[model samples]
Target chain A: MILARGLRKSFGDFEAVKGIDVDVRRGESFGFLGPNGAGKSSTMRMVAAVSPISGGELHILGMDPADDGPSIRARIGVCPQEDTLDTELTVRDNLYVYGRYFGLPRKEVRARVDELLEFVQLTEKADAMVEDLSGGMKRRLTIARSLINRPDVLLLDEPTTGLDPQARHVVWDRLFRLKQQGVTIVLTTHYMDEAEQLCDRLVVMDKGLIVAEGSPLTLIREHSTREVAELRFGVAPDGDSHEALAEKIADLGHRVEVLPDRLLVYSDDGEEVIARVHERGLEPVAVLVRRSTLEDVFLRLTGRTLVD
Target chain B: MALDQRADDQRAGSTAPTSTIAGAARLFDYWAIAYRRTWKGSAISSFVTPLLYVLAMGVLLGGFIKGDPTRLEGATSYLAFVAPGMVAAQAMTTVFGEVTYPVMGMIKWHKAYFGMTATPLSVPAVVLAHLGFVLFRVGTTCAVFLLVMAPFGVFASVTGVVAAFFVQLLIGLAFATPIYAFSAGLKDESAFSLVFRLGMMPLFLFSGAFFPITNLDPWMAALARATPLWHGVDLTRMLTLDRLDWSMVAVHVAYLAVLALAGWFWAVRRLSRRMIS
Candidate 1:
């Protein structure tokens, strides 16, 4: 549904999105996984046809945005980072009015309004003012409003960023259902769990460039070990002070990374690594065993913290 | 407004419910919806306030001026001369209120324009729609002012009052679209407050609306002649007095139209620059 090559966005002298390439397949969930200043939002804005590209060759649904912005915008749904819901209108009217922007027939807009409100579980709040809704409800309404055009591609910029855990899960469930129904989903999120759950393929961005791109499982397999063992030491809170411990345990596992409070030992067998640690008579304060995740892969790839 | 009827036809299950959009009419629906929610609070600015100016200047002061012959400005009565002045001034005031803070707020505060442009609507379409709604507001305010002016028997003919409506709309756009151009590039409301106090208030008082520009020095009169509101006031006053000057009418209409056209160009350029990034 979307394709870009050598995409670049610059504001005056500062380039927000350095030259990069991306392709989002139809009916699949694609994600841009990066921290705050990783050019994710810039990339998403360019894809949504709201911002013009400073330099790039881009196409959405096979049409260039520079030549066909309005026509291209007609077939895509965009949920910006901030909720742009009309605060004065009713929750349902927000959907109805936005659909009218697409030049949709009023009857079709009304029909879609009903289905969307029910889909987002906003039926009871149909007549209520948008200003009175809670944060989670507002996010859901934004999502529902985007879907009003029956768009071919849905672009979400951190759809679940400020929501609570339960609210985030509800949004994830709704998004998963949309994917099952064959809507191409493209989103940007800093949450590793969000990327792991929703994105079939994603790019890890750092600065203005992409460092890696792959499926979540494939990324973990390629960039991280199968299992990880965490170790803490009696030293300064700064993880660099535990370099002595890193040296002692460096040969026990395939790789070792020292963080502020914990040391990560990467190996195929976490139990065997822990036994080897005990055999070395290095009794750490605490230890934990877990499978390698996108978090580990992201940390390994970018060397930047996920959340600022 | 016929969009409502078409929507009704669509709901009635007409043969095919196609959405046919006219020039900037669809974008006007956004402001119309906003007006439906906030119109009650707007009465102070649109209806009640403009009428008070009519009463204060035309009715209250007309008593003192009726005994004096010089202040009549060749008209039969003071009420006759000042009532249309109030109408033209109200059009400028109403349109200034519509354009300045609201245009800046939609971009910097509420972000409504961004929401509009996120869809198929272009930046120029947004500018035209906003100015279109501002014209609608000018019509509403002038219509109410005309009714108030009628009891004083100020209309020389029914067409004179009808001309007031069209003239007010033209004057409103002439004043609004330029300020809208300035507002599009503003990052803060500091300039918005100044435009009202320093920019619009002086023009409202000195643009030959309250009194004849001939009373001022030649230089101030020339300055007033350059303003869109002065032409508006001059035009409305001539129509209300049943005295039509063909040459001045042509000049005044051309002045307001040119300003409106130039301001529209600036508004489109500045707004698209601000929005399309």
Candidate 2:
């Protein structure tokens, strides 16, 4: 339903979004997973038709955003990073007024307001002022507001960034329901688990570029081993010892990943690798055996430290 | 039977309804929200300023000029002459002030315009909606001021009140349109402050709001006569004192109409260019 080729956005001398290509299919959850300033928000804004693309060929719902912005936007729902609810309005009025902006009739707006309020679980507080709602409630109301037009595609930017664990789960459940209804969802988040849980396909973005793209499990299996054995050596292994340990594990597994405080042995079987280490008499302080996940895939692709 | 009926209702309601008038109606809804949310501050400033000016300049200052035929202007009291000007001045000030700051806030500080633009509402629709609210406010303030002036023996006849209301609307449009244009071009809040200080204050003082422009020097009087506010004040004063001259009234109307048209044209061009580009 959405396609972009050589899409670029620049502010003066600095480029926020370099030339990149993306295509999102209908009825699938797609995500852009990146740290802050990784061009996720910039890319979303271009898709939302709020920001003009500097250079690109873009289409949403088979219409060019440059020429058909209003018509394209009419069929899409967008939940921005910051809540833009009219704070002076009642919760129900927010939905009704937003519906009116799309030229919805008053009767239909009223009906849709009631229906959306029920969907977001805010029917009881429909008449309450928006300022009186909590952060989680406000986010839900924003989501409800976006759906007033019953849009074909929904864009959510960091939908659960500041929510508590319970609130995050509630939002996730609501989003899951939307997906079940066959709505196309596109979102951006720094949370690895969120991407894994929600996105059927995702692209890992770094420095305004796409570094990797695939399903969560496919990415993990491609970029990392099936099993990882974490070993922590006591007294912080010296350079010589670290080299020796890397050499020892190199023969035992397909790959050996060394950190400042720990060593990772990547192999097909964690137990087999551990048994090999025991036979070699390399006493370690601790050992943990776990399956590979998106976190390991991401860390391996884009380092562990946060990027601005 | 009930289940069948509910299913029928759902089928009937599934088709979306649309309206061409929805855009204008939604703008009014937004204005209603702004008015209800900011009623207290809007009321105090619009009503209180004219009343205080009437009290201080008309009643208090009138005591010192007691029995001075030159200051009284025929049979009209000092209160009568000054009250209508206050009404006209307040209407201009109130409308100009309300439209500029709030419109700029929507554009920059709060980003309300961005929010509105994301919807199907057009940019011209937003600008017109804001002007509609400004008109409503200018009308209300003028009506209340006229009521207050009538009890204080400010009006010579009912025509005076009608003329005052008309003048208020004219002056408001004249001031509001250019300010709207200026606001669209504003990069910072300081530009608005500078316009108010250097432009608005001078127009208020020199536009015959307090005293007759004839008392000023010839060049300054000509400058005042060129302004819409001066035409509004002169026409309002003439109607209040029942000194109705058809030629002079025609001139005033023509002057205000031209100024309003010029400002509106500038505003429309600037707003459409800025938003659409």
- DockQ of each candidate, alpha-carbon based: 0.35, 0.29
Model 1: per-residue lDDT, tens digit, B49-101? 75777678777877777534355555677778888888888888888788888
Per-candidate Cα lDDT values, in order, are 0.84, 0.79
Candidate 1 chain B: minimum summed lDDT over ten consecutive residues — where? B11-20
lDDT of 1 by residue, A165-227 (tens): 999999999999998986789999999999999999999988889989999999999999999
- Model 1 residue runs over 4 Å out of place are A234-240, A278-283, B1-23, B43-45, B66-71
How large is the interface RMSD of each prediction? Answer: 6.2, 4.8
Per-residue CA lDDT of candidate 2, range B90-147, in tens?
Answer: 8778866876778777776656666666776656667777777888889888888887
Model 2 per-residue lDDT tens digits across residues A1-308: 89989988887778888987899998899999988888999899889877788887888988888877777777788888888887777898888877777766679889899998999999999989988998899899989988887777899999998999888888898899999987889999988889989999999888788889999889988999999998888874353477677887788877787777788888879988888898888877898899987767767887763333
**For each candidate, what TM-score against the reference?**
0.93, 0.83
DockQ of 1: 0.35
Candidate 1 steric clashes: 0
In candidate 1, which residue pairs get closer than 3 Å at backbone N, Cα or C atoms, i.e. clash? none
